[model samples]
Target: MQKPLAYRMRPTSIETIVGQQHLVGPGKIIYRMVQAKMLSSMILYGPPGIGKTSIASAIAGSTKYAFRALNAAVNTKKELQIVAEEAKMSGTVILLLDEIHRLDKTKQDFLLPHLESGRIILIGATTENPYINISPAIRSRTQIFELEPLAAADIKTALKRALTDKENGLGHYSVTLTPQALAHYASATNGDLRSALNGLELAVLSTAPDPKTKTITIDLPIAEETLQKKAFSHDADGDAHYDVISAFQKSIRGSDTDAALHYMARLVEAGELVSLMRRLLVIAYEDIGMANLPACARTVNAVLAAEKLGLPEARIPLADAVIELCLSPKSNSGISAIDAALTDVQTGHSGEIPKNLKDAHYKGAEALGRGVDYQYPHNFKGDFVVQQYLPNNLKKKQYYEPKTNGKYEQAFKIQYEKLKKLLK
Candidate 1:
């Protein structure tokens, strides 16, 4: 029986691999390691279908080592022991452990000594963050490399290669993909080569050959049908969750509405409402600041409404809040101002308060010369009499640098500048 197209088209050499140039490109660490045929235990982590398994396979093929693949979800300790025994006889064995985060204590304990004694060279592949899922003992012994999603162009190149490789690909099928259909597959898979390849195979094999040309013709509609909604491999409890949220907040802070909406949709699809609400509230005050106080209030209300409504319905209000916050003027001045003040306090900036500024209403306060010449700001013009408010050590310190991003903050900057001159 023929294997799946994705499985058949897996790259067996470093040169054939696409994307993740940071690792596979010439002179890169992994490239060098492969070239030298000297590799230590390591973990490859990222979202699905970005060539983690292929890299492991390529490493074993290039080095001429005995390679065995096992899934932690299905394979047992007995299977691992078999591989360990084989390694003892063969000198060294490359074990490609998939879904390694699921490996239980028993399996982990069995593999620990083999890993330590250079018997099993473990290449752990995980869709989850190793730091959170893998045992610290295992993590400390391995270098972790994060494989990113392939770009559309990279996926396109791989697709072309697969279509023409006569020995292991769809070359014998006479499949013809239009440019539009090809682009649709490349982009619609959202960097998952597995999804793209599977969709391509489905489109080709399911369609009848055109009688005149005797060739399978794949068009945009067929491509769209095959590759449904872009596959999102976001695990709400994993690094992808935090990574997307971080990008979403930064996009809003950077005032990029499109990027903010993109990340927001990823979270929405993953049903991460609670985390979305919490992050939105934080970004509103931390990034938006006092630029538009009303915008901040609206975000809070939206979060409340989203919580009550829940998913499907909750996504609407959350999206509404995201759009508003992205368009709002951004300012980090508030955070900067507070942090500056905190630094002064933390660094021993405290000094005695002025005698006139001290409490004088107590019985003996007047005799002690406190409040002798305190100026009442309420009685002066603009309700802003010049007087020392900070401790002596920080008398001239100025924080709260206002931004002029929006009309509201423009007004603030003007007023703040005027007050600075008057007070000085």
Candidate 2:
């Protein structure tokens, strides 16, 4: 059986790997490790099709070590044992274990000894974060290298190489890919080189050659059809779901409109209406708290409108709310005030309520002196009186410290100082 274009085009040397210059560039850790031929257990983690498997294979090729590739999602303990046995016979075996996140505990335990003994040089490839998914023991034992998405220029260079390589690519066939079609594939795939390469191959193979010239032509329409906008891996209930939401909230809180919008676009693309709406509401109250009352109300109204409209149309209202919240003045004084009060209550600092402030109309006899000293604040000017609201022991404690972030909070701060002096 013939291998797929991507598989066949795997870089056999470290120098040929297109992207991730941070790792595979000259004098980098991976480059140095491969050059020195001193291998160790490590994990290469990133998104799909950015050359995790190719890097592992290329490492083995460079060092001229025995290479074995296995899928951790399916391979059994017996299969690992065979590889381990082969490593014992052969000096060292470079094992490229893909989907290391799904590797069973039993297999992981079985491979620990070999890894420590330098018998098997383990190269685990995973798209998920190793810190989140891999076992702590394995994680501690391996050097973790994070790979980023490929740039458009890198993908373009790799595509051009494949187009002209006569051995494993579509170079032998008479094909013409216009510059527009090439740019479309490079950018539209969203940093996935595998998608770009596969789309290019499909565009060339599926198009009929012209009778006179016998050449396959790939234009913008063909490129668009072949590379139907790369679907992002946004599982609603998965790690990506929480990651994007966290980034979204942080961006809004940090007042970064561009980053906030990027995350919002991801949520909108994934149709995550409920999560986005809830996050926006929380940001309005939590981050934008007490800074601007009207802004908060507007955010609440926007959330309601989004909820009523549903997705596709809902994203617009939510985006409006997000931008408003991002640009608005930020203050967490409301949440901070409540948290301080809660802490006092939970940590035994809460004291008894003042007798004058207690409920006096609820079946209280006047003889008990419950309402004897209580004076109605309405009778005083500004509905204010010099009366103790907190217990005697906690009279000096202040909870709400309004910040001068927005106009409303600034006004509150000025009025609050005057009121504090008058009450005292």
Against the true structure, whose TM-score is highest?
Answer: 1
lDDT of 2 at 339: 95
Query: Each prediction's Cα lDDT score?
Result: 0.85, 0.85
lDDT of 2 by residue, 320-422 (tens): 8888999999999999999998998899998887766666676654666676688898998878788887777778888888999998899989999888877
lDDT tens per residue, model 1, 1-424: 8898989988787887889899989999888998997788999998889899989888887788999999998999999999999998999999999999999999998999999998899999999999999999899889899999888788889899889988988998899888777776666565789988999988888999999999999877787678764223322222354578789999998989999999998877755565678899999999998788789999999999997998789988888889999988888888999999888779988788899899998899988999988999899887878877777777778988999877788898999999787666
> What's each prediction's clash count?
0, 0
**Considering summed lDDT, which 10 consecutive residues are worst modelled in model 1?**
230-239
Q: Estimate each model's TM-score.
A: 0.65, 0.62
Superposing all C-alpha atoms, what RMSD in Å does each candidate have to the true structure? 13.4, 15.5
* Model 1 alpha-carbon miss at residue 119, Å: 1.4
Question: Which stretches of candidate 1 lie above 4 Å from their native place?
Answer: 230-314, 317-320, 332-424
